[model samples]
Target chain A: MHGETAPPPTGPFADPALYTEITQFYAWHMALMDEGEPDAWADAYTEDAVFEEPGRTNVLRGREAIRASITKRTAELAAAGTVMRHWMSNLAVTPQPDGTLRATYYSLAMRAPRGERPDIFAHVVCRDALVREGERWLIRHRHVGIDALEK
Target chain B: MHGETAPPPTGPFADPALYTEITQFYAWHMALMDEGEPDAWADAYTEDAVFEEPGRTNVLRGREAIRASITKRTAELAAAGTVMRHWMSNLAVTPQPDGTLRATYYSLAMRAPRGERPDIFAHVVCRDALVREGERWLIRHRHVGIDALEK
Candidate 1:
């Protein structure tokens, strides 16, 4: 119901202000994780944000729940002590008519244990996200699918 | 050397036609793969393209080599009979004074058997691309890293 603002003639895709703000959010969002802090991930989304994957029936709702999920994953991955580096690129920001923004990005994540060929795990995607809450954007909903999924 | 088309009063991060061309490139580039053509991948890049992965010296140089590399990868993965889908989203298009667009995208690629919890691959950043050949945007250089590499 927060669609009061008349939709901009052009979506955020062509707006530098909105585009840069959202892009910076992405960089900061990852930096928090890069420093091994999952709590920040929870705070990044809105209070009523929704996180969904392909198979998981339990949609992570609310900021607290979102934090819990990320924390659990972080704990498990931290045990291995493998340095995780995320390289995000090929991003497209589109503005919806409702004055919100939707974006798609390509990401390549690599993991290594101090040193190691078979160490590359890449996920490329067309992620669709809704941005709201004024200039402050939070991912309202996300649908994640892998590049190589069995049909 | 390609900075001849610099505008008189260009604002920061403002480029409509440039982004349009770039976005079109991304859309069609992904579609080419959806068509299941490996050669198309190579042709999508410049004659001198560089594909680099973290902690690896396996840089494939030139169009022919790049094509061969992609062909080998496709052939190897095809043996598993798994379907591959590349989804690119959250694109940040930055136009340089040199007439080339710098784009950053976040990506998620999933791989698995039909109706299963596919292995989730997260690519953090895929960057360093150049668009040349007039209205044709091909990846000149690509650098990719992973998020959950060890997990």
Candidate 2:
């Protein structure tokens, strides 16, 4: 029931403040992950969130599970001396009838061997269901679809 | 100057009508391409639009060139007896300061030989700058990034 603000008369189509919040959500999420703060990154999700990668049959439900999965991945990457950066773009947010926001964006995962030129390892399109908790938008469900399969 | 409609007091954050229009834009674009209506698909772009697929060095500017490129690709697919379907998801649309909209989505292209189980051929994240031409939203610039490289 946070819909008291009147929309602008012209110019941008969406509420500028709402848009800024969503964009910042992604930016902060990425920064947390890249900085090796798995727990902090996972805090962006709701307690009962569902995380899935359809192409890989990876599904982790609940915030604790999600955090564990990311932590394990981070450890593996660190052990291999590979640094990964995820670049997300082309984000679209939609308001659903059920009082939730659906967000979609494309992600490019670039990986390097410590000090090498990063090569694109994965290109993914992500769909997220987000809910507002207090003043923050936390993810409730996230689905990632990978573009191509390797040999 | 198209922003006169007031947003709903509750439910989704985006203007429902604008969200519908943007989603339908993608639906129509995909349908036109899948149905072999290249001209109609190309019409979705502005006269001076830029279409780029950096992974393939494919940059087609202008509506006519964009049309030609799609037409050629359609013919080649037809000749090879491949029926391709492009599935787009995770679509996010943002209103820019320049009175244009930026749309980002994920696309998964599936291809099959007439009667085979379609296999994923490509995954892409697309970022589009769209302009409103009368009542329709048209692409002003499009960038497609592929997910993976081939061996």
Candidate 3:
């Protein structure tokens, strides 16, 4: 293993390089989404991707659907002078035998209004299926589950 | 430089290994502090560490002093049914010529009350000097500045 994480390392997780890459990916990827760049954010996913939000009965399939959904949401937030930041913690990544990564993390969605303090909009547990192509890793599927629906 | 962090990297920051170590160190270290283990949290720092919170006029010198401070605060928080979690983002780790790491990150201090949603208690910029001992990285000096005083 690598770093100080608790582990009996297995598969791709054993490589510290993979660990660093995955963490950096989300850190960069989340900022694009939070900053209202739907095209850039959606490009991080595969062309045929599945996005699931069971609490809202929103299971959007395909990259175009994901891009369109976020574009609409970000436009509304921009008009309202609000910014959403997603904080990911306690990440656990496992490499599946089928050559995909099963990554899970606790996500905190913080909503900050212009010139105002931020609050937790939602607390979610996110699981992602990632596929590697060339040197880039793309999200093939994302399943987001909320604890205690905010709405 | 490795991973997907914004470029041009230098020194230890260019080493993906160091990046992994520093990130993992904080992720593990913060949990110990947030979980109310003052001793464990303080032990992550050097014995002669300096902790500074300029806005609060609290400049603690030495690990024992740091432990004492957190212990008191954590006790109060536990009695009042509160938990404080620090979410770090946009980390920048630079290696000084003196063989120490100059690390900086944006910290979101989230305050959670019992059975209630958490909110941002404070948004602070934290900078730390880290020294490596064998495979362990310990905090030598930490200076935290608040963007806007919450109180």
In the range B1-151, model 1's lDDT, one tens digit per residue, is: 2476866553575365555545546655664554357776667777788888665337778878878877777787677666555556666788777877678876555454445434644455677667766434668888865554424
Task: Rank candidates by TM-score, best first.
Answer: 3, 2, 1
Query: lDDT scores for all predictions?
Result: 0.64, 0.74, 0.79
- Which residue segments of model 2 deviate by more than 4 Å? A1-41, A46-131, A139-151, B1-13, B149-151
**lDDT score, candidate 2, position B128:** 96
DockQ of candidate 1 compared with the true complex: 0.10
Better of 1 and 2 by TM-score: 2
TM-score of chain B of 1: 0.78
- The CAPRI classification for model 2 reads as incorrect
- Per-residue lDDT of candidate 3, residues A1-151 (tens digit): 1234623222233247777678889999999989889899999889999999885657999999999998888899899989999889856567788989988766888888878987678766689999998989999999986542345
Tens-digit per-residue lDDT, B1-151, candidate 2? 0112423211223344565677788988898998899999999899999999885767988999999999999999888888888876555566777889887766767677777776656666689999988988899999987654322
Alpha-carbon TM-score of each model against the true structure = 0.53, 0.59, 0.61
Give the 10-residue window scoring lowest on summed lDDT in candidate 3 chain A.
A6-15
* Model 3 steric clash pairs: none
Candidate order by DockQ, highest to lowest? 3, 1, 2
TM-score of chain B of each: 0.78, 0.87, 0.89
From the highest lDDT down, the ranking of the candidates is: 3, 2, 1
